[model samples]
Target: MDTTQTAVKLILDRWEASMHNYDVLLQSLSDDQLQKEASPGKNRGVYLLGHLIAVHDSMFPLLNFGEKQYPELTKIFIESPDKAVAELPSVQELRTIWSKQRTSLKEKVDQLKAEDWFGRHTAVSEEDFAKEPHRNKLNIILTRTTHLAYHTGQMIYLK
Candidate 1:
């Protein structure tokens, strides 16, 4: 394949591996431990998990695949700080959503053509995208992979 195709493939491969590691880390947690803070003032495992889910949910809309699967997640996980909101979704509920959303997102990503990975995402205007093509769907995957890795580290503190 061409350079773009090769690069996109590598990105997807890394993304899949990163997600697998995240899943293993999450599966290791107990429900009781999920409620504890990662650090004194930091977010809990449940909150971080929800936040990651919400961010991934946004990928559908952001990458032009479809609307977000969990808009409500934005309010509790993205918009509000941990414990700042009176209540958040139950850990079981978020885990269900996370599993479903990950499968859906993987299917969507798998369906993309090599060229599609370099196409501008939903956030960019046509004119701007034409000028700044580097900000593409693959960029989001790379950024969000780093994000998941960061939170995965925090999750260890909760254990």
Candidate 2:
């Protein structure tokens, strides 16, 4: 494999491992535990879970795989503050959504070719993206990896 191919494989492999770890951690949480905040005046585990799902759902359109399935998630988790909402999806509900979303996303990512990983992502014009080839689908995976790790740390407080 070439350097770019090797790098893409490494990123995807590591991302898959991280996501697996996150799934394990999330599944271990109790409903009571998920309600507790990591810190005072901060988001709870349930909010964090929903927010992560919302972000992942957005990746569909952002990466040109498909339209977002959960646009309402943006209103609840992205646009609104953690505690601003009177109601959010329960842990069980979020778990069901997350499971389906993750499975679909993994299938899409697995379908990508090495060249597809390097293709222009959403919003970047073909001309501009050709000039800045590093701004591609793999970059989105890298960014989301960091996001997953950050939220994983907060969820750790639930344990």
Candidate 3:
């Protein structure tokens, strides 16, 4: 494979591995366990899960893939702090959404060519992209992978 292909493969592989690790960690916890905070006064397991989903849902629009599948999640999970919302989707419901959203994102992302990964995402203006080429579609995956891993680490405290 050429350098671009190799780079894309490596980023995608790491992103997938991060997602898998998070899935395994979340699966190990029961629904009741997810209701507890990961640490005292910190975000709950369920809140973290919803927050991750909300962030990932925004990626569709940012990456120019499509509109967000769960725009409502942004208000609850992203805009509001953990207990600020009066209610949240059940843990099981969040799990199902996570699974479906991740699968859909993977399908769309996997279909992109190597060059497509290097192109600017929708969030970047053309003039800015020319000046700052590093802000590309692949960078979103890299950053979001790190974001996932960080929250996954926090969720470990729940166990």
lDDT of 3 at 61: 94
lDDT, candidate 3, 2-90, per-residue tens? 99999999999999999999999989999988999988899999999999999999999988999999999999999999999998999
lDDT of 2 by residue, 42-129 (tens): 8999999999999999889989999998889999999998889998988899999999999999999999988789887896888999
After superposition, the stretches of candidate 2 with alpha carbons farther than 4 Å from their true spots are none
State each model's CA lDDT, in order.
0.92, 0.91, 0.95
TM-score of each: 0.97, 0.95, 0.98
TM-score, structure 3 vs. true? 0.98
Q: After superposition, how far is residue 35 of candidate 3 from its true place, in Å?
A: 0.7
- Give the alpha carbon lDDT tens digit for every residue of 35-117 in model 1: 99999988989999999999999999999889999998899889898888988889999889999999999999999999989
Report clash pairs, candidate 2: none
- As for candidate 1, its clashing pairs are none
RMSD of 3: 0.6
Best by TM-score: 3
**How much RMSD separates candidate 1 from the native structure?**
0.9
Question: What's the lDDT for candidate 1?
Answer: 0.92
